[model samples]
Target: MVSLVPSLTEAVAETLPGTLVGATDWCSHPADLDVTRVGGTKNPAVDRILALAPDLVIANEEENRAPDLDALRAGGVEVLVTVVRDVPQAFRELARVLTACGARSRPRWLDEAEETWSAPAPARPRTTVVVPIWRRPWMVLGGDTFAGDVLDRLGFENLYGTHPERYPRVPLQDLVDASPGLVVLPDEPYRFTAADGPEAFPGLSCALVSGRHLTWYGPSLAEAPRVLAEALRAVRR
Candidate 1:
């Protein structure tokens, strides 16, 4: 796998084990796979793929850097891009994409993982979560983003419901005044960590979470829901 934007790349590495390669600034996984270091607007690793010459290369149309993708295509590579927008689309596309790429998915991984979230009970008071991928100034996920859908499924509402765009940047003061129940900093975009959460957004309950679990819509979805279920439980406390 040549993943310039992380997310599903980490999933492939973590779940499939030794199956990932060529990760960028966005990827997060165990340090076993021989990853090509490419990040911060410099893709030094694209030159490396020519000799390996694999059977298939998978990418996301929206996330993977385009120039590098074009370079790969120029090398007579068969590139298949998966653009998954929602949870249902995510699951449906996974099997087809994996099969197309000749990758076998473990049975029932998607359904079993998604089922980890109990149906939201009226009894469980909702937690308003803000999934911040950027916070230098501040950007939040709004409705219509995959992350927003994930939060809804996990039994929470986006505090930035009024924001029009899927991913919008706003002022930090407003975010603070919104008084989010939980401030979730993603591992990518902003790459916020557990240690960074409180220092970044002081005076709010915060947690660090896998951005891919909430945003990556691919075969990774099969495993992400369980990761989300675990995070949701923790956020509720």
Candidate 2:
């Protein structure tokens, strides 16, 4: 089996060790894995992957681009594409992947996370937050992205989640119009550092945050709600 993402690699390895063939180096997954780091500008160990002759290649539909998928298919590789944005979608995708690969997956922590975080609660003011993936243009999760839902659980009103599309392009003026209480810049798809937060987007209540837990959409989300909640608590007051 071939895995495309870091969380998936970790999950597959944990679920079925020695089954996963190899993983990409620059996919920006949580560290600690048996992987070969191909340059960010280069292809993942494609030669080695081909040699492995993986019966099935598992990849996220949104995570892997069309060109890459086309190439894989053209090469006579069997690829399973899974796209998951919400909790349900995530579960569905996970189940499908595990079953196809005969890899076992029990979402034990998903239930624990839901019972712990998704339980009903008293109402509070939804904190307005803006998540920036890039600074020059200030792209944010506009609507229906996994990051948008992560903020929703924190009683956060995603100022941009209501936009026309997922991962919409946010002009600086539009962000200003949104009037966010907290401005969060991520470390992946774009690297937003604590120091960069000030120089790039000044006059905003900003912080640099790990994008994995927020953006990753596997069992890893079991950790996201708690992790994000901790970060929000520190910054909200």
Q: Which ten residues in a row have the lowest lDDT in candidate 2?
A: 36-45
Candidate 2 clash figure, as a count: 1
Maximum-lDDT candidate: 2
**C-alpha displacement of 143 in model 2, angstroms?**
1.2
TM-score of 2: 0.85
Model 1 whole-model lDDT (C-alpha atoms): 0.65
In the range 1-237, model 2's lDDT, one tens digit per residue, is: 878766566556655657776676654444555554432223454556667778877777677666676676777778888877765676567667777878555556545545565554327977788888876667788888867776786678788788887777778877766668887767777876756654544565665566887777655667776676666565421
Per-model TM-score on C-alpha atoms: 0.74, 0.85
Model 1 CA deviation exceeding 4 Å by range: 1-7, 10-26, 35-44, 104-108, 114-123, 193-195, 199-203, 216-237
Q: In terms of TM-score, which candidate is strongest? A: 2
RMSD of each: 3.9, 2.9
